[model samples]
Target: MPPPSPSPSGRLQWADVPPPLRARLETTLGAPVTEAVTPSGGFGHQLAAALRLAGGRRVFVKAAPDDEPLTAANLHEAAALDALPPYAPAPDLLGVHRTAGWTAVVIAHLDGPDPDLSPASGDVEQTWALLDSLTAAPAPASYVAAVSAAPSAAGLLHGWKELRDDPPDDLAPAARSHLPRLAELEAAWPALATGDRVVHGDLRADNMVRDHDRGVTFVDWAHATTGPACVDAASLAPQLVLTGHAPADVARLLLDHPATAGSPDTTTAFLAALTGHWHRNARRPAPPGAPGLRDYQHRAAAAGLALLNHRLS
Candidate 1:
């Protein structure tokens, strides 16, 4: 069954119901459209609309702005949806429409709220259970290669160096100090060839939801790719803390994993670079010492670094 849908709010926009496309959608969906609006973020210019179609079917529509790569992902997502069964709660692909400059996928809305990511959240067991179910599915060769090719923090750091923008004085010193180490970490790409698991490259809390029994429904397959099971484990380990798992436990599990269980130095450098990358780009500033994703990233870096340093000693 579809998980709960997100709460609807605000007004519709041109992107949600452009004149050129509205007629086609109404005719095809066979429903009166009463409302539409852009959902939050997605790759490129993406918007999701909730519409009351004919026969009282409440359908969700995802539209991508006219572009090459965006069109591809929309089609790709539709295919992935088709391949996977109804087990893990993902948006159901209803239909695909391609225009001169745009591509859109109509899908059945999952009926649930976004999973809370607050510190009090304690749903790791649930999250991991869902992950297990997802991994149990067969992954194709192309899917694995595409996910492995997804943009990495190492690549972004290289771009940042090229741009030479002045980071905040407080941040610059640490970032500058870590630049070499980051490069070193980037060089030591661990072997991820042990498994053929389908992975969600970006499985943060916002992109996931929990059901009435705390069952998980991971959304946003743009980052879904075939890769090492450990990569997914490492990516999700940090999130456990935000969802109420003890950070220590999360770190231990990720560290103990065979794929990630390597030299302390390599692990430290990898974790540091990963968190540093996110902190540098994604996190918003807040009160000093306030706990949030940024703080957690810093701490993960420190812990990984400490493990590395100890091994070196």
Candidate 2:
């Protein structure tokens, strides 16, 4: 099945990259560029595209100006890609370069469509299988040191309290009514954090692409961090709701998944906090370059609230 809804991917294209930066990329690869194609999904990065070299190698590159906010995330992704153990399922980092005032990350281009996230799709099993393995693998010492001071999933996932401080007028009726309870549950969010496992701090369909013969390849490690394995699985639950699954089904799926089953802390509280994050951000005006992001967040917020309400029931 295809995605339930496709979000607008308004981002910097290859044609828009400065000539100086473009020349630097080709020079770094030691090959003349053949073609560059923008991806069909995602809206976070400043510039994202797959560059094919004359020598027949294709690499995916994402870049932003050094002063741009996304440049930091591009750097963090390079670190995560390098820091992860070889056993991890992420793409290989091809190169990291800072040239012409732009920070760019290049990785081996993934070769298929994003896995179908519908309720009955087998991709869900493969998705969790990867996460189960990821959670079980010991985080590398280098990775630990690299992100030593960076925020974990726990710290970044909190938003309910913020919404509580200044509730937005457009919240879903259920979310608006349960604001106090959601905030109370979200306060317990920190309890779920742990540094024992690697987490794709933001896990969702748009961040993945798949090949049936080889399984799925996860992309966009910008939000990658160390946290309890359950948090990674928890991140995908809201997205499932955006697909075809009912809120109750999504809840049961997480409550039963190996990566999350044992961790009750992964359910109600995490979902509430995630919902608040989307709802709060969705209310804000769209950022300068990334359009459709707020709408994606808004849809995710509603889906998250539905699942949260089901769990609360």
- Cα error, residue 231 of model 1, in Å, equals 2.3
What is the per-residue lDDT of model 2 for residues 1-313, given as tens digits with 9 covering 90 to 100?
2211212466676766667778888999989789988787777647788899998988899987788778888888888888888777788888888877777898888888888999889998888789888888668888776665566556566677777788767666797788789988887777766657887887889798895456787888888877776877888888888988887877888878877888776566777778877887888888755767899998998898888887777
Off-target runs (Cα >4 Å) in candidate 1 are 1-17, 37-45, 85-89, 118-122, 136-168, 172-180, 190-195, 211-214, 242-246, 256-273, 280-313
- Model 1, 202-302: lDDT tens per residue? 77766765645435677667656554555555666666554555666666665665545643444454454455555454335743222244565555444
How close to the true structure is residue 189 of candidate 2, measured as C-alpha lDDT?
A: 79
Q: Mark the regions of model 2 whose C-alpha exceeds 4 Å error after superposition.
A: 1-9, 165-169
Q: Which 10 residues in a row give candidate 2 its minimum summed lDDT?
A: 1-10
In lDDT terms, which candidate is top? 2
lDDT of 2 at 280: 79
Q: Per the 3 Å backbone cut-off, how many clashing residue pairs does candidate 2 have?
A: 0
